[model samples]
Target: MAPNFSPDAVWAQCCEKLRAELPEQQYNTWIRPLPPADVQRDGDTTVLNVRVPNRFILDWIRTQYSTRLEAILASVSDGPVRLDISMAARPAMARPAAPSMMPPNAQGPHSLGTMGTALPPNALAARASGNYQGGINPLPPSAGPHTVVLSEQGEHPHNVVGLHGGQRRNGHPQVMGLNPGLTFDNLVPGRANQMARTAALHVAGAPGHMYNPLFIYGGVGLGKTHLMNAVGNALLADKPDARILYLHAEQFISDVVKNYQRKTFDELKAKYHSLDLLLIDDVQFFAGKDRTQEEFFNAFEALLAKKAHIIMTSDTYPKGLANIDERLTSRFDAGLTVAIEPPELEMRVAILIKKADQEGIAMPEDVAFFVAKNVRANVRELEGALRKVLAFARFSHKEITITLAREALKDLLSIQNRQISVENIQKTVADFYKIKVADMYSKKRPASIARPRQIAMYLAKELTQKSLPEIGELFGGRDHTTVLHAVRKIGGERAKDTELNQQLHVLEQTLKG
Candidate 1:
């Protein structure tokens, strides 16, 4: 008989290593709730058993923590240790039954407005009902179609699809590609992302029945993915058993290619069409991919027919998705489309503070403001600046302060402080058009001067936060309506006149530098 081992001691040591390695929120969500079930020795290998509450977590542990947990166990044990994770037996309890495919109360906190009934497809009837095998096993599409099953090539599985006992905790299932950490509760709302966040939360509460397909568009690092994941998590909170798929368009393309090579087209259909909710990021990648778009179109229609909610993110507006099939673009625009503008000053500071809090760092308000003010590009850059400040403080054994932040981000601040003034923009545009800078602020009605000035105005509107009146004042005391007209004119022509567009793009790039 193999000797018994202490599961409690083994798990405690594992937790210690994980707590040190992961962020506090990550540790708390994925590790802290785990219970040590049992331990046994199988020949030279020591096996430690830990129990999770549901299949969702069981797979999450295997996918995310299997190797790390094994190494941690080995480091703390007498010999090599492997983990065996499984779902615990549940006590009978009443679960919030899924509501009929009826319109959710628009006045409800999460619902947006009146939407017709649209439930998930027929495949949702099939659920995963078996013990987790320490490793991922490929199950039929009916059994949680979006569930990430390893392909023997070590690619990350896309999403975990379903629930057992209709219960999950903390965040959504890692379905499709949802990140557990980007919940709606943690997302800071501001003028930039208010509408987008509101629509997302509404979709989360009602799923397919409301906001049948929510389209969120924004520039890079502006929380498009974060909002989509928050919706997925919110849906998971309500319907723990929901089959959700959150994946990038590139991932979808890759999966399609793989299936094509393997001659598994039916499986691809099953995988995507089976979901109760689909959240695809960066659908702009579908541009020029005729075959991929065809497949997606079919799946899209299938999902819509079943009333499955779909959410997609793109870096540009649906109408601006050039080189993409018009049908797909029109379909994308058919739903609730929201734009996430760049965060304003106040929102940026709040984001920095929130990120600092998540990192367990005490960032003085002034320090946060310093970093936020300088890192004005996007949330990603703001977080990066904060990380640098935190790293410097930790290494120097000093507290975070404005002085420390300045010293830590000197180079970044220098680049950020190079303001793109209207004068600089006018000069760049004039030089590019071989016209005089004086033409910018002058009433020069000549086509050459007028066109250049209009382009500059359009660029100002797109790149700066200046009000139309402020911009008009800088452009020779013109009325705000004149500025608006110039902006609209240039914007309309930007798509049609490639040379004009290129000239404006180059001028904008030079001015930003």
Candidate 2:
């Protein structure tokens, strides 16, 4: 008989894979809260009935997250799994309630909590309509001591907050100077970006959000950078000159190091202190660097005191981040964290079309799908593949077709399979848990050694796409039973344990890494 896969089992695994492949925003909104309804086979293909609260949720999942859904489902079962999203009545099966109003994509203690004093002028202006219905925790209206009373006149339209005490459009705004376009309207909502998009929208209008410090993280090509930029651009429009300075965290560290080297700490402090909005990208780079962490801590403290809005981007969540100091971790935890994962196949196609539209390239749907399939996980790389396919078609005097996409992406397509090797998976799992390679295949039963080994087995099965028997042979002649235990054991643990869920996610990094 075919393997009987439970929806809960699939969902648990989905969370693990989605968190790894997607952002926290995507995870919570698209996958975390949502539960799988049923898994049934359709001829040679598998049909997955995934339920969402409403039509908007279904639509968003179909658009942004479908590719990832397919990839993940493909892994759990042998047959092709296609996602069918629907708005059904609440199921009889008990599921943890989904947070209707979660924290925005990149909110922090200031944005969500009682702390964070330097409120951006735009944020203040947004407070005019009291339209902040989003975020894990909405900022209570009781803040005071400002000479200018918060009111309608302070609210400026077109993403600009023309309040008495707020920053400029070019300036960052802690207030509601959100660019209207940056609202859910301008965002191309799809399965891939839906969760992140929803979380961001909530936070853009809401505050005191639990998804605070919205640590939107993902591979290089995913839209983590895009979503965060949209937040800044949108909010900046609301509060022009609200003191927004967004740069790579590496830049932040370099500046700190430079200041330390040149004795310009005071100047750097002054620059950061003046900001109403601060955005730092690739925060993981600050890991393992004590001085940078110390400086970041100070800057974060100063910003919190000022109530300036802060946003950040990274490849890993605050917890997964290794080598970072504890103080830094605590501060990071003080805010909401959102993650942006790779766009799914449909989203990739949408991205391709969006790019094509931007470039006036007429790409057929078939051609788009072909390109999307090969482009795989990295949103940027996927778009690049589309661009190349278009360019090659134009340059080679050929129409955009499935064949055309294949020939064009012959190089990029090959790149994905290169890293998904057995040895690579073993090493990746080992490196992720900091275990030795010998330990991976050794007979030792230490949970430390065995758990990571199972993770390796799971990864080898998933990433390399090798048969269970093949995977079993790869790990010291361990039979398929061992591989089965790894898959099932990790799946079971992931279902109940959030930490293990996160670790499994970290392991999926092998596919992309």
Candidate 3:
């Protein structure tokens, strides 16, 4: 309560508190690097301004530590205090040298030679040329019992050991956790995944040059994982020894936890930071796990500093994720973020036919169309329906036909029909946006109500077998032109607005359920 209270003293006390409460590595990585605060007074409010070296640290501190820092300031200060975090300016002449991408305990490249397959002679040149080869070094023979050997046919055992047990040959790890079967050649392209696939292909062709940390997101079974794997496979094909690893987000979390328990962060860094590319799936699972986020953040920074590419998939876009640190999410959004929408009708038909051909079954075009029309949720469902139809044809000793397809997919068709009525869509959309269902029919024009109503109209037209006039009639007798307008507006915006597209995806999934 002293009039001459020093903000520096308060900040010092806050740092001491954080140091005591947080793990040593976390405190050192995040808190100790922060510059001193510049505190001032304006209109009875004490403003504490903190500057960080970069946007990453600024976002990290603001999201993870700002509230606690503010509380500490308020507790120590006499009046209300506000926190303002910003990036510090870098002086051109005196800017600090970039930190080594190597881990703290690592001596040199030779330090890792004992752990896995030895690096090739041209490894440095390849890395500098953006053609880096090899993934994490395979564990020593004594480290594990299983040894995964990559086959020439691009097939590996289903129960292949994890990343570390892969075989070593010609001084390169043979298995980089990639499924060679999932490649760009086999992945059917469509408007739904066109943008995402293009970005992925760019990353594959020239890793770490553009779209660094490429992010792909969408609903379940919509080919997010397939796209990520395709990128890794493409890179591996170009440089057989390229260091690449593909894994789900939970696997990374497990690695973090295991290393944390063993106090072996150096090994963790050596494995992940040395890669040419990282393809991770479903990063939304990283939510709420502080230690994992911190470690992943470290790996992410190291890879980028070394110009290594990273591809991550999630059920939602970066900003749409929950319980994740702002710094990580911000980094996730730093690169190109694309969505794999549910396949369109033509694309779905194409997928069914292609997959059937791959199975050596001659799928009639009409049957493919019939299956595509009914199984509109995603490619996975489309594949499942194709399998059912194929099996029914084989067992019944008949040619593949629409009549057979209908009988095969009767249950799915019934479920689809039972769900997703216009009324159900209106109710779901209203509940999602926290508006009244009646607002869909009412003349309310506020954005909050109108947006959800328009979304409902669009879904009605897409999901139900309703024409424009019929949909309009269901929506409180609105004009067919209004219904068409809503559909067109939402359809156009859905392609451009990531947030709206995500919202619509959620509503569609809920209605389909």
Candidate 4:
């Protein structure tokens, strides 16, 4: 006789295991919010249907937790287990109730008098004409100064002087230019962004606490902006009334110019100095602008003084920035500084599959790998390549496959192959480290030369299809074991050494370009 199988019980056990295995924040953010799985039996297979709120969560779970979940399910069950993840259907909106026909003295379901509330004549007219805002109550002129209170369940109520000012349609304050679509739920975590992501999470959970004035620097299209937006969105979700703003450094410059022309510097101070959080991007643009830097420094000092958190991003680190005032740069570096490196191979593969899944097309793992291998620059390039392949498949009416992907991305692949070679890698690495290209093929073993040589070997192995022996032959006739040892050593060190990883990322980007 077989034992009874309860899907909810099994899933609860799995959750207990996951909560123990994962960090509290990660489990709560990703796994804890998930509803119980719906299990069904098909032949000899036990299928567990896992529903997520959005494709971002779906992709994240599929990449990070699906294997572990399946294993846990199998161990707890009596037979084979399969996990299927999909987005849950959105709930239907509730219809509004009809107006009551009761007498003025009678208390009905929609009667505000029963709750000791009375609307102004204009407010009643506005509501009847569908012109009233959800959360704002229009008061008569004689009513004088009125305060509106907004509160979520079990949270302190927020008082607003003018509820009609800058409120969103849903009654919440405008999230200060934050894109609601960008949140921690959608931003995929990987080794490339592990440090930066961790810092962002810390700041998000407790803004104005740790990592205050957090600085995130990275190359373009490397998800720096996405991470910043994610932090802002997370904070906004927790505190609906919190004042937050996200803007480009150029926007600050524009504001400076505008206010300078009008001689309204006080207005500028009033705007930026009152924020609970500020998310700024591309501060490199402030390099040559004296007035912008001065104004930004003022705002930065004010924000820090008031214990408001500030997050900024740029193409390079603070010290690497040129033509910027030392005072401002010092303030920028005063707090925690972190770098977001280019995604590694595994991360690139995960990003490709997740994005492809988001398009409602099931991309085979092999095809995704093929695309990921070829498009190695950044997320933007990977997305562009995926778009081309998807468009090609649709245009040709063919299923997506490795061959089809190759044909679709033939031009990109051709350019990449032509530009990136062992010789190119050797030259790029040599140039970046201020070494000689000839040293790549030399027998010299100086630390300075040997380190770059090992890096070249790693890049050659990673970028090309050359066998270990062939790479050794190209590297001054070294043995295959020596090449393998160099590759392993550098690869391992890259994981542990942040500086070395960043250098490798720069070299890879240069070579790919």
Q: Largest lDDT belongs to which candidate?
A: 4
Off by over 4 Å in 2: 1-187, 206-212, 414-513
TM-score, cand. 4 vs. native? 0.64
Per-residue lDDT of model 4, residues 117-187, tens digit only: 32322332222222323211222222211111111100001121233225553333344566656656666
The superposed Cα distance between candidate 4 and the true structure at residue 444, in angstroms, equals 2.3
On a 0 to 1 TM-score scale, where does candidate 2 land against the true structure?
0.53
- True-vs-predicted CA distance for residue 438, candidate 2, Å: 17
- Give the per-residue lDDT of model 3 (tens digit) for 405-499: 99998898778777879989988999998999989899889988988889999888888788999999988999999999999999888765444
lDDT of 2: 0.60
Give TM-scores for every candidate, taking all chains together and pairing residue i with residue i: 0.56, 0.53, 0.63, 0.64
Model 4 sits at a Cα RMSD from the real structure of 19.3
Whole-structure CA lDDT of model 3: 0.70
Locate the minimum summed-lDDT window of 10 residues in model 4: 148-157
Q: In model 3, which regions exceed 4 Å deviation?
A: 1-166, 169-174, 432-435, 441-474, 477-504
Which candidate has the highest TM-score of all?
A: 4
Using lDDT, rank the candidates from best to worst. Answer: 4, 3, 1, 2
Clashing pairs in 3: 133-241, 133-242, 133-243, 134-241, 134-242, 134-243, 135-243
RMSD of each predicted structure: 25.9, 16.0, 15.3, 19.3
